[model samples]
Target: MATMPSSEACSMALAMAAVEKGTGDDRGMETLQYSGWRCHRKIHARRPAGGMMPAVRRVPAHGSWQRTRGVMVASQFITQLAFTLGLPFLPLYLQQLGVHDPQRAALWAGASATFSGLAMALMAPIWGRLADRVGRKAMVLRATFAGVLVVGGMALVQGPVALLALRLLQGLLTGTVSASNTLVADSVPKNKLGSSMALMQTAVFAGAAGGPLIGGVIADRFGYRWPFGATAALLLLSGLLVLLGSREEFKPQARTQPSRSERRARTRQIWLLLGPIIVVNFLDQLAGSVVGPVLPLVIAHLAGGQQSGVATLTGTILGSVAVSASIGALIAGRLTGRWPPPQVVAACAGGAAVFALLQGLASSVLLLGVFRVIMGLFIGGTLPAANVLLGNLVPPQDRGVAFGLTASATSLGFAAGPLLGALLVHVGLRAPFLLTSGLLALECLWMVWSSRRLNSASG
Candidate 1:
């Protein structure tokens, strides 16, 4: 009697044949065992012979990275400008609307931010799923246009309740950064992902640095509403560019339902990979939040009752750091080739923690501002490294969800920061900064540990 081929051998043979045929064989031979040989042949034969060859997709070239970077940067600049313009003035707006108690004003402000975060957290995953089904570019357009409408409405609203409601709406719709990240992940090659993400992050930091300064100026002169209106126009323009100028490449593929065992295995893998990323983001945000809202107050106190230039001084301190952050991002972008992302992140986080500790001890506005700039440099490097790591770890098919989870985590941190700052203020003005520095130290430890584990596994 002739010995028959084992099931595993049979599957491997079919897979090899399919691969050789180049047509319908694009699906890995791993699927043949479950689907059976005849079904596999039929499915594999339907694919064009040339389809098995790597499809040539257009991506940003090294030369064109600058131009693509410009588009994404401009979009982030306007979006952040809108976000930051409202940040300083929102408390004052609540005060004007009959919230007499300082605690209430702070509470209202915190609630508005919290609701926005909750909305973003809930909607981001849905949007990510949609982006994968549709295209990331299309999602970018949606986010931009929706931001214009929701943020513009904030200018026209009559009361704090309305403003809060509008902010909630804004969070539900405004996912431009998340979409932009998805686009970058899709377009940039793995080797170049770190630099590309860093450049994109610089746009974010630049916008954040400028937004508060511009908002303060507009609020000082034309009132708060004008800043919102200006932001609305900029957002509209950004949306139009994404909708018209950018192109997305998506290859259509037949979807198949996975077996229960396969689904469970994939879920386990995703959780294992995603868990550390989420923890890193949470710690980073928590530390940042510990100081973010209190920074302006710290500057004012350091100025010794000189409230005349508080807004300007605050804007200057924040903007100066942002400028430094942008520079750091640019430098990190270039260094991605020489240094691995985890090392860069750990080093940056360590430096940022040191700066945070220094800021806690500073007695003058100048000292605080100088330290902030240094802190910005470190913080600026973290995002790109995190993004690049995510891009490398997750498969392209699942990138949308990966990025969406990241966006949601960051938003949650953003929302939580002010509240944490507000709470810490009850103890003392400088307390939050010191606390933040401690948290960052812990985060640095985590980063180092996680990085080593990942590297060891890969090695």
Candidate 2:
């Protein structure tokens, strides 16, 4: 734990010595208590009339909070792994659903991803607002259970159109990752928020890494549809784990009626604080999703082998990217305290832009895999950095809607990426990567400009 600042320490020492001197200066002590609390809500520096450090009383609660954090992280890992299992094979699934032409497959892949994203984008804020009123845990349960239904329904669809519709519904109902993140944000101490968010992000990357490798093997052995069923089972298991292992004490905000001027001012303040962060979040995901729709086909073309062999090779590439992302998340979690998140985000964006451009130029699968892994390392930091910044910028009571808005931005970016991919893939497989790189580069410049503007305004 960090010690109090020098001024706070001095006030605390004087307050204690005064009490010890048997002065019984009630008004002075009360004033000190109020001042201490005002200076920092996390540190309860003042003591009772005969007292010791009141902050010490909060240690046991902190320990419990740590335990809760552990449970949520584990749950997040399981849920993410389950959720992402089908993603690597989405284009393959489209192939099985009656699309035969590669160009059309790419377009459909992008369209399906965009459809899901649009649905999720529409629903995220509603779920987020509901989470604040109900409980985050409830939202997690709702998402996982909905995943069981929506993903499982994918198994029953007969064509690409039906599959896309189910996926759209899936987005409407499922947001387990977001729900788990909200839970983590609510549970951790204020000072440890970034670390906790980073740790959760690592779990996300781990699951993303593991799921593709496992799902690829499963899809190869049992066919594309089995993975959906398997994903449903995993979602069911995750829901059970959350129910049995985690606890949340939720208190709904009191309803208040505000004047139009006050509401307008609040809305303007929110826009000023969150607008840039949301755009950055969206554009980052958009850059990454450019590869999602056509990666398997690219691997298949490079490997020049049976479908089964291609599936395995594609999994290897996907897993490598995810594993690199996990490593990046670990590094990002450590660096949040040392560097400002916007600076980190800008650096990561620039790095991703460079690596993505390199990926576009690669001629072989091996070279492409290497570039993607490097790109993943940079791409991984973006979300956690944005989340940490959002957490700090918004009050706890409003964070659900704030994160929801970010989620919407992310979905919008994700929706756009594949569409861009579909359109560019006709030019060549390399086009999407180059295009994404250009978008990311543009984003980096914008973020740097925004950060400088904000800094100058503050100064």
Candidate 3:
């Protein structure tokens, strides 16, 4: 038996003893006495006044997370699809709008893209911090609905400047992906995080792949404006889905401020994990976008300068690569569920680098397409693995900030890639591809070395 205390402890313990012995009719009375004794014990122990204990809050499990994921995925799919669908034809639209100079057209298009990315990069972290305070689902819903309005309004813009301004606004408002990632980190069990993140990556890539094909067809048949109109409608519908289908359940943390040392430790941890992710983002975007803005021109040149047919062929190449990538993402997701994320990421990076290098070596259009398809497969798996690795590294409370930082890194890489590709085109058409491939190879080495270090530390 446990030892009982003397007179003071007995008085402190009497109420609890009475409650233990009390019947249903006497339970309330004994509970009240127990509260009084608890207060007394607190005073004796020199604890905070009132002796009130904070309630243990239970976080929502699979069901809530899954529902939020579904809504978020739907919203992302539609908005991203709409945005990507119009991207391939934006320069063409600019040219048609009286900016016939190729240099000017390219400059304007690049500026619009840069502005959009800058807006997103600047706003993502702010929105993320807000989500942590208010509620993630609410922020997601707001972003989705705001995207609907901004993108839909983009259809009515009369000039390139107006379009660029709207695009910037759209980026500032739409942060659904970042919020969704944070929600998943909070709601999903640790064991299933890799698979869930993989599924998210698949959705993003699949949307990206399908959008261009559909947009190209629409642009070829209907008009440039028609594609934007269609995209706007889709975004509106997606926003509705998010508003109707999603629910937010906020759980606030205990109110305790961190010390300077604790804050420094956390900051160090964040930078340590963030460094590799930033590198991965840069390399991934560099590899993907190095071939992007110029692929149509490449196809046109290959097809003996038939610019009219380039859109269709470019769409075909993009779609083919995306299909391969989707399959790779699914496979990687399953594999990573069983394997460590860093190992999977390193393998994917190495494979993508080899295929990207082969892209620069292709002597025929058929061979280039084949290499691109292979590259897509490997590249498709990289983002999912990176996200899963991040999910594992960060704590739930800080996940929103971590995801926002990642979004910023990705946006920066994306913003820079097209410009780099354009600049390299001055040297040679294949220079960008070769350079990106080399960078990717370096990234692969980094991943391998980092994974080894992580393993050694863990062991």
Better of 1 and 3 by TM-score: 1
lDDT of each: 0.71, 0.77, 0.70
**Poorest stretch of ten by lDDT in candidate 1:** 30-39
Writing each residue's lDDT as its tens digit, candidate 2 over 1-459 gives 112236656456444422222444454332211112112233222345555532111122567678778888888888778777787788888888899787798888899889989998999999999988898889988988999998988877899989888878987888777788888787677678888888888888888888888888888888888878888898888889888887776666544577897678768767776788888978888988887887887777776634667767787788888888888887887777887777888888899999999988888889999999999999888788778877776655677788888888888888889988888877887888888899899878877877863332222
Clashing residue pair totals per candidate (backbone < 3 A): 2, 0, 0
Off by over 4 Å in 2: 1-40, 43-60, 305-308, 452-459
TM-score of candidate 3 to 2 decimals? 0.84
Q: Please provide, for model 1 over 292-380, each residue's C-alpha lDDT reduced to its tens digit, 9 standing for 90 to 100.
A: 55565566578885645566667777777888888888877777667766777788788999999998888888888888899989888
**Residue 369: error of model 3 in Å?**
2.2
lDDT of 2 at 288: 83
Which of candidates 1 and 3 is the stronger one according to lDDT?
1
Cα-based lDDT at residue 432, candidate 1: 80
| Root-mean-square deviation (CA) per prediction | 6.8, 6.3, 8.9
